[model samples]
Target: MKIGIISDIHGNSEAINSVLKNIKEVDEFICLGDIVGYGADPNYCIEKIKDIKCRCIGGNHDFAVAGKVNINYFNYAARSAILWTSLPLKKENLNFLSNLKRRIELEDNVFAVHGSPQDPLLEYILDKDTASFIFSKFNFKICFVGHSHLAGCFSFSENNNQVNYMNFSNGGCIEINTNKRYIINCGSVGQPRDGNPKASYGIYDLKNKAVNIYRVSYPINLTKSKIINAGLPRSLADRLSYGR
Candidate 1:
């Protein structure tokens, strides 16, 4: 089965729509969350994810907008976005975000989380040390995470007692080695931070035992205009151009 793995949608409807259209051929979709912050379309994104039956996990921003996390946890722009996002969200969408699980386990020893397995809603497993420590905390052969907004993977080989990080910032495919465990980040659909402006996603093929990261262009200017028109932070709209 080929599962489309997406993370950090961040309320950018254009980016999410483009990703969904591009990955529509996959058998299923799994969302790593952040579905409701930093962009201009929380309700639209939520409805779209639900419409496609995407299995989702709660992200920090999602929780914040749902009133499950303190707004103070975010910075000025983010907090403002969170407040703005919350006002327009349907009660059902808020409930959906509020009830989302932080972690979910799939078949084939695959696990999914919005953040690191240790702290699914908050932690950013960005380094070899953190990945090494996190490896001991989860038994899954592959743990897919999003929150760092960087497309990459960390593989730990028990035989060599080594953890290696590979950057897929430009998108690529990696075969899963049974001897090595992995922590994979599919990057972000709406708010990429790996210096790549294109929307990012992943296709995990169980039959082939490979994970393919992909980047695609979307209508960034449209999203930026919406952000500006919606009264969201100007910097949020500006950063979309730089992918920072």
Candidate 2:
């Protein structure tokens, strides 16, 4: 079976549509949250996820918009976007965000979380120390996460007692090693932040025991226009071009 992995889709319909269009066929989709936050089409994005029945977790932005997280915790631009996104959401869509779990365990010893396993919606496992520590917190052979919006992989080898990081910002593939545990970030489908403006996603081929990261271009100007038209923070729209 093949699973399409997506994360940090901050309400950019253009990005999500482009990603969905570009990824190869899969048996399922697993979203790492932030379905609505920084962009303009929160409802549309949520609806698309719902339509595909993607198994998703709640992101910090999603929690903030759902009133689960303190709005004050976010920075100015993110706070403004969250407040603006909350106003027009339908009742059911709000419920969807409100009810998302912090983590989900899938078949084949795979785990999914919005951030790190220790603090699913808050902590970031970006560096070596954190990745090493996080490796001790989960028992899954493969953990998929996305909160930092950077696409990458961190692997811990039991035999060598070593941890290695590989940047997948430009896209790459890896053959799963049975002796190593992995923490994979699928990157941001909407608001990529690894200095790449293109939308990013990942594919996990269970049968083949391999993972592929990919990046695709989308209609950025269109999403930017929507963000500006919605009266959201201009920086939110501007950041899409730089992916930072």
Please identify model 2 stretches exceeding 4 Å from their true place: none
What is the C-alpha lDDT profile of model 2 across 1-244, one tens digit per residue?
9999999999999999999999878999999999999899999999999999999899999999989999988899999989989999999999999999898877768889998888889999889899998888777899999999999999999998799999999999988998999999989999999999999999999999999999999999999999999999899889889989
Q: Write the per-residue lDDT of candidate 1 for residues 1-244, one digit (tens) a residue.
A: 8999999999999999999888857998999989989898999999999999988899999999878888888899999999999898899999999999888777868889988888888899989999998888778899999999999999999899899999998999989987999999989999999999999999999999999999999999999999999999899999999999
Model 2 error, position 147 (Å) = 0.6
RMSD of 1: 1.0
lDDT of each: 0.92, 0.93
The segments of candidate 1 whose C-alpha lies over 4 angstroms from its true place after superposition are: none
Q: Give the top-scoring candidate (lDDT).
A: 2
How many steric overlaps are in each model, in order?
0, 0
Deviation from native of the Cα of residue 113 in model 2, angstroms: 0.5
